[model samples]
Target: MIKYEIPETLKEHENIIKRTFRYSNEIIFKCEETKPWESKLGGCPYLKNIEEYPVDEEGEPMLFLAQINLSDLEKLDDLPQKGLLQFFVVNDDMFGLESPIVVKYIEDYEENEAQLIKENPYEDNEGYKQSLPFSNNGKMYFETREMPISSSLELFETLFKDELSEEEYEKLSRDCYSCNSRVGGYPYFVQHDCLGFDDEDFLLLQLDIDDECGIMFGDSGNCVFSIPKDALKNKDFSKVIYDWQCC
Candidate 1:
C-alpha cells in the first residue's frame, strides 16, 4: 500500500516536487473512480479504503498544497475529470524500495487536457501488466532490455544460434517500416501489409527453420517479430514477446 501525505506549506510542496525528480521510481498519474470504479489496467473495479484514506489532522481528506495550484495541473498533458488523482510511482519492492506517490481525492472535479491519455496503458506492452498501478489500454514503451543489435545477422545469431547465409540475410533485410513512422527501440508482434513489407525487419521464421520467433531488426535496434499470419492462430506466439518501444 502507498502512504499519502498533504504538504501544508509552499516549502513542503516544493520539497515534494523535488522528491518527484530524485526518487528512483517512475511516477505516473492516474485517476481512480470511486462510484463506478475502473482499474488502471482495466477489467475489475477498485475501491479505496475509506478508513485508511489519507486525511488531515481534523479527519478531513487532505489535499496536497501543489495540487491546489491550477498552474501545476495545467502542466500535465493529459488530466482526468473525475475520480481521485494518484501518482502511481513504480518501485522495485523486492529490494525494499517503496513508492512515495500520494493520491489526491477530490469531488466535483472539472475535466483537464491531460486526461486525454488513453486509459489502458498495456494494450501492446503486456510486460507492464504487473508493474502499473492502474489498468488502461494505453501504449507502453518501456524497454526492459537493450535495443536490438545493429547488425541483422548478429541479431539473428543472438536469438537463434544458426547462421543465415548472405543471400538469406539479404532477402530478409529489405525495406521495412516501423508502423506509421520510424519509432526507435524494440519491436512487438505486429500486423502485416499488402506490400509484404510491414513494420518488420526480417522475414517469417518458419517452424521448421527455427522453432522460436524471428525478429526483423531495424535501425537503432527497433524491430518487429516475423510471425506468419497463419501463426496468429497459435496462442503461443502471442505469449512470447520482446518489448522494446522507445519512450
Candidate 2:
C-alpha cells in the first residue's frame, strides 16, 4: 500500500515502482514492556519447567531470542492458528549461526505466569544478555508495504540505467529499503545475496540490528529465518533455515 504521496523524483516510474518492489503483509514487532511469559525479545521464556528449556550442543543453556504468541497475531495467511513459537540461540560470538539453534512450538499454552520458568537459565551471561530486550518484548502489529529489497536492487537499477555507478546506486537506494523487525513479509538484508532463501521459502522472522534494544548482529547485520510455505501452513517449523548478514 503505497498510500503516501510518492516522492517527487520517483513518481515518474509509478508502474515500474509497483513492479520493481514486491508488497506483502508484514507483522511488525512493536516492543513494549511486558511480563516474562508474554511475547517478547528477551527475559525468561514461558516454559513448563527448567527441563523444558532448550540447551546448546555443549549442554549450555541457550539465550532467549524471541517468543511469538500465535494467538496474538490474527488474520495472517500463513501463520499457525494458535500456539507459541519460541526462538533460542546459543551464547557465542556467532550466536548459534554455526551451532545448533532452537525453535520451540507449544500447541497448548500455560496461562499461569508463576508456573512458567522465571529464572534466567544462562545467568552467567547477564552482562551479555543486556543486548536483548529484557524489559520489553515485541507486540505484533500489521501493515502492507513495498520496498526495494536488497536482492532486487539490480532490477530497480535496470529500469533506469543499464548499470549504475557505485555512488549512483548508493544514492538512488538511500533510505529506500525496509529494515523493519517483522514476520511473514519481504526481508531486508545488509548484503545483497541470500543464498538460503528461494521461491518456495517464506520469511518466517527477521530481527534487524536495533540500537534501541541494544541488539546487534555483527556490525549492523540482520538475523532472519525462512521456512517453506507449505510447512508454515502445517505449523511445521522444524526445518527453518537461519541466516544473517552485515554490510
Candidate 3:
C-alpha cells in the first residue's frame, strides 16, 4: 500500500510548479469533456482535480499538488494484472507543456515495483498458496533436473553429451551461457528464468523448453506436481511451496 504526501516545500521547486500547472489544466479540460486542439491531450479518469493558491515560496508561484490514486497494490500479483497511476491537470494546454516530465514519474513507479516483485509475486499475500513465483516460461524450464553432475564442467557435458556430435558440442559450447556462481553450480538445475522458492531462495536455471515445466520432487522423487500459476495468482507463495533445499 502506497500513500502520497506533498511536502510544503514543493512550491519552491521549478519542476513542481510546472507539474502543478499542467495537472490543474488537465482537470479543467476533463470536467468539460471536450477534445483539445491537439489530439495528443486525451482524457484520463483517475485525475480528480487540481487547486492553486496566490502565495509564493521564495518568489516562485504557489501551487496545489495533483492528487492521484494508483491501483491497489494488494490485488496485483501476477503478470496479466495491470497497474497504473494517474495525474489530473487543470487544463489540456498546461498539462501538455509538462507531459514529458510527469510521464517520467509514472514510469519510475513501474520500474521500482518490477524489480521488487520479479521473483516473489505473493510476498504480500499473507497466506494462500504454497508455490514459487515463476513466469510461464520459467516454470517450464526448471520442472526437472537433468542429472547430477560433480562439477560445473560435468553439468555442461550432461546437457550436450549424446545429443550432439563433437563439432556440434563446440558450437553449443560457444553459444551456451554459463555462470559459475555457487547458487547455480553442479547437481542443481539451471533455469532460463527464475521462480521464488522462498523469500531468500529461488529456483534457478530451469529452462521451460515446452512451457509445461511442472514437477514435484522429494527424497524418492515421488511427489505430485502441476502447473500452479493459475492457482497461485494473488496468493502467497510461501504457503504453497512445500519442498525446498538450500546449501
Instruction: Judging by lDDT against the true structure, name the best candidate.
Output: 2
Tell me the spans in candidate 1 whose CA falls farther than 4 Å from its real position: 1-87, 91-97, 106-115, 132-247
Write the number of the candidate with greater TM-score, choosing between 2 and 3. Answer: 2
Per-model TM-score on C-alpha atoms:
0.18, 0.75, 0.19
After superposition, the stretches of candidate 3 with alpha carbons farther than 4 Å from their true spots are: 1-78, 83-159, 178-235, 239-247
Instruction: For each candidate in turn, give its C-alpha RMSD to the true structure in angstroms.
Output: 21.7, 4.2, 26.2
Superposed by TM-score, candidate 2 places the C-alpha of residue 110 at a distance from the truth, in angstroms, of 2.7
14-55 in candidate 3: lDDT tens per residue?
Answer: 242233110000111122221111111122222212221122
Give the winner by TM-score: 2
For candidate 1, write residues 1-247 as lDDT tens digits: 1222323332323342233221011112233321222212122112233343344334433211112211222222222333432212222222101223333334344344233332222224444343332223221111111122222233333432344445543432331111321112212223222223222332211101111211122222222223333432332233222222221
**How does candidate 3 score on lDDT?**
0.24
Scored by Cα lDDT, where does model 1 land? 0.25
TM-score of candidate 1 to 2 decimals: 0.18
lDDT score for residue 59 of model 2: 81
Error of 2 at 212 (Å): 2.5
Q: Write the per-residue lDDT of candidate 2 for residues 96-160, one digit (tens) a residue.
A: 78877788888888677777666566654665565442334444455665554433334444554
